[model samples]
Target: MTIIRQRLNELRRRAFAGRTGEIELFRSMLGAGGVLFLHGPGGIGKSALLDVLADVAGTASADPIRIDGRDVPPVPGSLQARSGSGRTVLLLDTYELLAPIDDWVREEFLPALPADAVVVIAARRPPSSRWLADPAWRELVRVVALRNLAPHDGRAYLAG
Candidate 1:
């Protein structure tokens, strides 16, 4: 168990590099009853950032439910049922694959969630214009464009 724990810690450290601010911002936004949409190009570390956010949610005693678009059915209702009542953090990865249900999620599923439930989406593209165009959603949503790690952080990650 100790060896497994150590290995997991090492893997976590290696998976995330120089994303403390992002993680903290996600946490703060969630605490304030907000949703986060993280987007970036391929291999830009969006998935890794989601992993870190999950860890942060766990530490905060919030239930983190991770939904990968590749594995889930391409339906909005399917995701709606996944979010049970509680202080839950919904982590949606590969969100671009679920483009068909994007409007449903933004308009129906998210609004139906409990006030404390937070949704975190990581995608390869920015959010649809509908989210930005709507004056109401614009206030509740936070969009972050992830970037590559710094040189020092990259070196530290590789050295580890």
Candidate 2:
């Protein structure tokens, strides 16, 4: 996994501005089996983080099922077929694109994921009330917010 580590370091340099917080966030999310939501404003590197995660997972011999929430598929069956593969890390990029999130979460993600899968989700905002209010849904998901990078870090990321 040395190459993966190197790639992560590079991604961190270019994407998160060498900020240790984002790296720590990624490390914590790695191998974690549950729903993970990363919410942040536009231009704050949310998509870049997802790309870094996918790159790292891609290099580790781990199967990655990256679904761009912007271009979400029509059928849940296709999603299931893709993510059910072994040792898969499924990333739902820009999750807010598919709002009314409960329907998508229930009909697609929850069913598509394997018991041991790691799910990473990046969103512009948290899900709607019906989703947030559900105890069962709350039980299964971990929410993380991405604040803007510190000034020095922001400069570093922008330098690239």
Candidate 3:
């Protein structure tokens, strides 16, 4: 990697302020098995949370596979192939772009994962009805609503 890219990543990590509760919650989810669904409006920090959690997953010995919905074609096969055969910490970003195959993902793809695998889905939209309607999913899923950072946290981010 270029020196600039490395520096940028370092800065990003350093600039990640606040979210202590969210980070703690994320750490708690790492050791256990289940899904974490983070949703909110634009620029609410869902993606940033996922990025930080990916690093946390690495420290926990879970291989993190990050797939941006915007980068891949809107096909289940493409997503499936990149999702690490259900053995890794799957970070699915920009889920709005992958909304077309939401059912396939929830019904077919997620079920195939290992019990120990961790899947974190970040999106602006709330999970579909099926996710909440299904009793099984209700047990395995945790929905965290991301809100705007506090004034102090925002200021800290800027100051960093």
The candidate that wins on TM-score is 3
lDDT (CA) for every model shown? Answer: 0.85, 0.69, 0.85
Per-residue lDDT of model 2, residues 1-160, tens digit only? 4788787767664655543665565556556666677888887787777777777777666867888766765455545555646786888887776564548676556855666567777878865666568787687667777897888877877786
Candidate 1 accuracy as lDDT: 0.85
Spell out the clash pairs found in candidate 1.
none
Ranking by lDDT: 3, 1, 2
TM-score-best of 1 and 3? 3
Model 1 C-alpha lDDT per residue in residues 30-129, reported as the tens digit of each score: 7777789999999888877887888788888887999999888879767976775678799999999999989888888899887767889999999999
TM-score per prediction, in order, is 0.91, 0.74, 0.92
lDDT of 3 by residue, 30-67 (tens): 76778888899988887788878888888888779999
Give me the displacement of residue 126 in model 2, in angstroms.
Answer: 1.3
Q: Candidate 2 at residue 95, lDDT? A: 73
- Model 1 regions lying over 4 Å from their true place: 2-6
